[model samples]
Target: MNKGNEMAGPEKEILDGIATRSVYALGANAASTRYCFRVLRRFLGEGDVLELGPAEGLMTGLLQSTGRRITCVEGAEAFCLSLSARFPEVEVVQALFEEYRPDRQFGTIVMGHVLEHVEDPVAILKLAKGWLAPGGKLFAAVPNARSLHRQAGVIMGVLEAENALNDMDRRHGHRRVFDPESFRQAFLGAGLSIDFFGGYFLKPVSSGQIEANWSDAMLDAFMVLGERYPDIAGEIYVLASRPAP
Candidate 1:
């Protein structure tokens, strides 16, 4: 998000533009934008919602009609501006999530594709745990390192392992890749429990490959396989909640 720097120059503009373009790309990201909502549907509760790293607000915009007040903490200034302009009702805080202190806790916190980019995932997660009201849920999602495409890469010897960071991931600002165990460890160590955990999108190839070669109907079918084999899906999701008190 914002290349870990202040928003300025052509680089930030280019990066900010990616989200807008990606909305039209109908690739993995657009797919994620759609699928993540389904993941949220299983756990989203009534009351205020806090969203972290809502770059350009694809999901944020979607959440608006729920009639729940949405507050967003974004790392990119351009993103904050876009989100504000696109959805004026949302409270957009233009700061890194770790730095922004919440005035109050939320009934639901949705963090999507953010942990993989942050420096200290557990610290952020620990922060997430602190920000939840009792019985509230945290809807979190991340890319799966051991996705079927990566599995194929491993068998082809192009990838050393499932956890191997490919050029595309590095370019997209992914600091680490996660299989289910590693992903679960981060949340568990942060002192949270996942009430439900599963995968969403079964990506048999890279996003670009899928967009280029597969039909929309076929892609929809692949999503079903994720429910059966989550460990190898393109993205993993969990519905986490605070311990009853």
Candidate 2:
């Protein structure tokens, strides 16, 4: 799942101990986690990558597997320790995104599910763009307010609308939900042009509910369904790069 969904889990067992709630995290984990990386693999260059809010490193570890130099800026102290311990090579910087200032530019910057957590999305996005080398890639992913299941909920008379926030979203600390238009506005303001955009991982239900009941095969099919109906996908992503000089 996308970072906005706050889907969580690290490859190691250590993450399980620190998670505040296992069920919610499992649901978050189900969002665009793998598919985003897989799509990004096609566009990432051979430059250093900076990851904002690595969280439980569910996606962070996968980013590491790409075999590129990655620097993670995470606000959580315990998580920083965990990341440092697990991937020694990764330069894990412990700072809120607003306070972080790296010495050099990077080739790629990943903001997976990060904007919804921040107070000022455009500001942070501008800062991310500022750290980019020319032609650097900017990968942004967020939870889709108009995801497949959310719409279903609306049609079923369960949810008020796609934008309506639920208890899980509140618990996850999400400040806002995004549709493509709002998501695109942030990038346009930050001076990053959208090179590619789409949704992934169609969710017919919530993560915890699905995890408790669905099989692995069913989950895999959900991802395929997302590709087919991105407008209703669980999470939406945009792959962008710095504008031409």
For 1-245, candidate 1 gives per-residue lDDT tens digits of 22233444553454454444434224668777776787687688877999998876778877887889999987666677778888888888866666677889999999988888777889999999999987889988998988999999999999999998897776666679988998888888898987888997888888878878988788877887787889888889877877665
| Per-residue lDDT value at 199 in model 2 | 79
Misplaced by over 4 Å in model 1 are 1-26
Q: Number of clashes in every candidate structure? A: 0, 9
Give the whole-model CA lDDT for all candidates, comma-separated.
0.80, 0.77
49-150 in candidate 2: lDDT tens per residue? Answer: 999978777777888898989899876566778778888889988666767778899999998888876778989999998998887888888889888778
Off by over 4 Å in 2: 1-31
**TM-score of each prediction:** 0.89, 0.86
lDDT, residue 210, candidate 2 = 81
TM-score for predicted model 2 compared with the true structure: 0.86
Minimal lDDT window, size 10, model 2: 2-11
Query: Candidate 1: deviation at residue 210, Å?
Result: 0.7
lDDT of candidate model 2 versus the reference: 0.77
Error of 2 at 83 (Å): 1.1
